[model samples]
Target: MLLISAAPAAAQDTGLNGMSRDQWLPTTVASDAPLPDDATLDTDDCRYDAELPSAFDADALRTSETAAVITVERPGPGGEGMDTCGTVAADGVDLPERLSLGSYVLYDVDSGEVLAAKDPYGLYRPASVIKILLVMIALDDLDMDELVPVTAEMANVDGSKVGVGPDGKYTARQLLQGLVMNSGNDAALALAGALGGTDTTVDRMQELANSLGAVATTVTTVNGLDTPDVQTTAYDLAQIYRAAFQREDVRTLLSTETATFPGYGEYPEFQIASDNGMLYDYPGALGGKTGFTDNARHTFAAAAQRDGRTLGVVMLNSTIAAGRLWSQAESVLDAGFDATSDTSVGTLTGGSTGEDAGPDAASAASAAPTESSLSSSTTPLVIAGLGVVTVLLAGAWRLSRRRS
Candidate 1:
């Protein structure tokens, strides 16, 4: 059964009577503009053309230009009866009603059982969380000790950077640290250049994700920056994180709270701090990635171990506030840990059919958004639609654990 704590008087005054203090704050983007006309909504590549879901109000989603058409398909038999598309289990663990998130998944690290999730297959901008795929691809293709020279293009990348200049030179290992620890866009560019170029690196990353059963992930940018075509689902992200966690090097880097990178050429030495607060605030935090863009609000993926159980959690399109994101993730992990082994509401397929797989394995994938005519002007509309659906169904699903 669901349990809700009584909100303080102040919370009620703020329209947060049954929510956490953090819930009082709005999402990173909050606007009340009118929904765009149906004629203006792009649907050329949308798989589903029927009436929009009842829970979502077209007017609510149209308020922001970020809205675009989002299609979530039910998983096939191989999906272990889990609704990859946003279906909450009738008897899953109780989740915090106050937690604000667009799409999220909590899974058992060892068993691959989905403990609780909302809009697991709903497509949303990944922000820098996509870097996990890049890290994995880089580790597989390049030697950790290989020195990579930074080029003018690499150093010119926009967004959060590790200050790697055009004259800087560092080993793949160093750049990997900066990529994960600081969400360094420069590190990503350098690594991408080392891997051949952005196109080649992104292609390989996509191939790897498909082979791993992350069918809902599409890589357009090496650093997980917001792109109209780049997208991922919380379900796919959890799969990616679980796969990355298997690598000792990845685990070590993610678990690291702080590290020092020596200077190269004219660049000075620098200390990099992890953006993932769970490493310091939450016990057994295995480290994770953080992502954000104007198009993609706060996004995060992390893992933690307790009582011999390792749990992985992913939250996408959340508030930019770190406290809110970490707190929400911690709550999911707590529920996952408290849940019994049989409490699984679903399972993450990891994009495989339990047989030999290759790049084409995901050609028939159902969860990932298909390439469409969605342009930057209409991206916000899709995001707005997804956000509305998530809000509508967030409270509809029961979180009670099933009793044998």
Candidate 2:
């Protein structure tokens, strides 16, 4: 017979550690991006058709412009190293020795192993990193070739934008590239409106985030310019990137260095450059997203491939000056590479750093069950099952007595 303890009293839903959830959940996709004009709402809708199918079939729930979902038939070259589930890596691993960051996390693309993470799950403002989610989700919902009209709201969106205005139009592809390559807050909002507008799009994002196990995270905006409530952790940001990386289209967008969108009238077609400085500085750098605000400081997430391994890293709420995030991430990349002495990221566990409780506590909670809990259930059950039935019966009797 099994015994059940009274469920622990529900603690208030606290932020990861003691950080306030409010610090994490901002209201607008871009807190600083200017609001769209209300007068042009009906005639000049900025929203894209996210639910359209590949065929533009009205009967389909998604739009035809969305990229067709492709299943990864097999793990990439090295398996996605997800092996860092049970414990953290040792400190001595060859991570760049000098780097200061408030929070950081790294994961192998193929094997899914979290090579290293610092304050991985601590909640912080994502700033523009949130746009990656908006673009990915919109791509899944809408058709890539479908034309989406730009509107005044999206054109004039504040913060960093591709500068493509609302009067012009673009296919889903151009907008997505603009969104990722330029870290366009306007592109994020326009996509949100196209997908279904701010409120509905955000709700859907929350749903997707939960399905992907991005706990301790909340999204209030598509652009992540900052809102009172929009927040996420480095761990959750990695989770979002992991999910996006699984899609070829999303990967293509992130890996791209430059994008061109033709202009209307005297507005010369623009060639916006990528915001990920490391892409220019580091050779193996694939691509990344950048974000910042007084409230958030500097935040960045990037992925790179070298010597047969791909590493994704995220830094959040760093107190350092601007541009330091990339340097810190570069260090993280070095540390991860050093951690794996083996060539093949070595079996998801990524060379298995032998530290006892090494990973950030939150990642450990999400990746696997604790050893103590497992030991308590396993050894006792085995002992009760093997002890000639007398002791097993006694244990059951004891449990019954306690319940009475």
Candidate 1 displacement at residue 112 in angstroms:
0.7
Model 2 has an lDDT value of: 0.55
The lDDT leader among the candidates is: 1
TM-score of each: 0.69, 0.62
Count of clashes in candidate 2: 51
Q: How many clashing pairs per prediction, in order? A: 14, 51
- Per-residue error at 187 for model 1, in Å? 0.5
Q: Write the per-residue lDDT of candidate 1 for residues 121-197, one digit (tens) a residue.
A: 66666778888878766665666668898987777777788768776668787788889877889899889988899
Best by TM-score: 1
